[model samples]
Target: MSRLVIAVFWLLHWLPLAVLAPLGQAFGLLLYVLVAPRRKVVLTNLRLCFPELSEGERRTLARRNFAITGRSMLERGLAWWAGPARLRAMVRIEGLERLNALKAAGRPVILLAPHFVGLDMAGTRLSMEGDFVSVYARQKDRVFDRWLYHGRSRFNDQLLLSRHDGVRATVKAMKAGRPFYYLPDLDYGRKESIFVPFFGVPAATITGLPRLARLAGAAVVPCVTRILPGGAGYVLELGGPWADYPSDDVEADTRRMNAWLEEVIRTMPEQYYWVHRRFKTRPEGEPRIY
Candidate 1:
């Protein structure tokens, strides 16, 4: 069934990306809404993250988030197959100049991009803005992993490092004065995290960004590309050149950075990619909400 789905995904993927962008997202949104188990995960995340919101608001957020996820998948298809230039028509982004400025500062700027919108294409565009390398994640199937790795790395010679080689590759590249982009969210089914205030709630988050930045004597920058309505492109918001990240207090830096990222996510709540169980990993005795 999974193989069949993947095969169908590949077959249908080529059509929308090549022809119609909005039509493509509509398909993805419908498909995900009808079939993905991740829907419940998104709803749970929304309710937990925004307790103060009324029930109707929570539902609205969930629907919006799902649409964003669909839009991201659609945009990625366009990015990989047809190229994401059309995606630029979807939303207006801010803070791009900040990235250019960071790159010129002589120190490699660590870009902390949240999973909101056209992150794939944004990474490529951001790379052109500066000397930046992004860590590529391993997808489920090895064949798919290789395929995705090549697609994302095609624009620039991004070192498609494996998870095991991530830190080594990043540190080496940073030493060479090249900036590295890494997603500091996601729970890898382990307790290797700190309870950080994300959306005013303690979301278990990876402290890798602050740790990596501190190691390279680099500055930490938060970037989020929001998915807008009507298949509008995206707005990539860049914030900060935070110094002394991941100080002696590991949890503090993690919390601070995560809070900043959460604010960025809040800017466009629906496109924030809430389907992933972000709080899957928790320390013993730490309250798990989702």
Candidate 2:
């Protein structure tokens, strides 16, 4: 079954962007009507995060997000199997010098990536620049897992450590000069997470970013990927290296992280990943939002 799924995506890989673009939008609309559970999740997230938006406005954003999500799924073919020249042409990178400066200073860098629809585009495009390492939870299905791992690591000298490897392994890799491509936003429960204000909602955010950066003596550079409408392309934007981060207060750093992510989401409302149950873990005595 997994192989069949891969074969479908592989076949889609042969299609031109002009064809795939509108097809993805139409598929997304179909999915919005068909996938009730996920549609509820997306709307629930948007309502909690942006209470100021009118119900109609929020609904519009929800639909657009789904379309972008669908496009991202279909576009994975280009990211995974496309030629180097083709992939390079599809991506326009900004603030790359921020990362380059970190490398020049002999400082290990952590790419502070948030959960966005175009995240894969950012990682794969940047992989072409230099060797980098990222952490991912191993998927359950065996055949598809192998395919995913290979597809992501195939581009350049990229290394993907499983989440089971823990922070010690990540710190070691960063110290060894492999820039850590870190995705800081996600609901992983309250184990290593602290309740922080994400869009004024208390969200369970991982503190691994600050702790790992502090332990590895690395600099944190924010990276964002914006998906262009109608399958035009994507832009991988890098920000300046953070100074005074991972300070004596871990909670403060985590709060700052969430605040920064919220500001970015405002710029491109629909591009942010909204299907996630971001506010799933609530404060003590509080009810669940999803």
Candidate 3:
């Protein structure tokens, strides 16, 4: 199946360049709905995170999340061809000075961006505008992986690392003055994870954040990319370096960081990727809904 996905991408990659972006976007959204395994994961995550929501509310949020997920798949591809100058037009960026403050202080800025609306563009643009940064990611499939590499690094310097090398790569990048971007909210696996309070519930979170910051002296900055309804484009809001967070008690700080992330995500709950299996690896044998 993965090989077929690769073959399809290669076939399309050969098509006229003009059709790729939109075609990819359509493919992403359609796959989000039809992709059974990830679809179930997303649905479970949504139910666990937002139990207070009515069935109607859950359905609405799910629909919106899948749409954004699909669009993110496509928009990121367009970002490559869009170019920095043109992308700046598409995304009206603000709060750069805030990020620069950390750079000026000789502290690398570690952006704590949870998956929101326009993160693909947000991450891409930041590297273009600033000193360029590294971000944590699981290696993607070959066809898409090669495509994303060109697309993401088009105008920016993206030092992407695999999950295993996450700690070492981030530490080195920040120590050398490169700003780092990581998603602290998504659920990918159980290794190196510590359950932390998220949205008033304990969620398995990456424990490397505070330790990395303490080791490398990088400041954690929260960022969110929100695409407006009716296609008004996207807005990226940046939140600040949490002053004087402890080197120890990482679990506590991770919880606090995730709590802030949850708040940001909740403001636009419908846009959040709720279909993810955020609570997939719960501590107990059975998963609890919220």
What TM-score does candidate 2 get on C-alpha atoms? Answer: 0.96
Judged by whole-model lDDT over C-alpha atoms, candidate 3 comes out at 0.68
What's each prediction's TM-score?
0.82, 0.96, 0.82
Number of the top-ranking candidate, with lDDT as the measure: 2
Identify the runs in model 1 with alpha carbons over 4 angstroms from their true place.
1-21, 83-94, 243-246, 285-290
What ranking of all candidate models by lDDT puts the best one first?
Answer: 2, 3, 1
> Which of candidates 2 and 3 is the stronger one according to TM-score?
2
Model 1 TM-score, all chains together: 0.82
Candidate 1, residues 1-290, lDDT tens digits: the string is: 54564465466555633344565556656855696577678777888888889888887677656555665664554444444454344334577667668666767777787776568767655544445677776888876665567556656556555667857778888777677777878776554667767776666677787678777877777777755455345566787677666688888888887777677666667777677888777667876655
C-alpha RMSD of candidate 3 = 4.1
lDDT of 2 by residue, 99-198 (tens): 8877888898899888888888778888889888998668899976776676678876787888888888898888888899888798998899999898
Output the number of the TM-score-best candidate.
2
Better of 2 and 3 by lDDT: 2
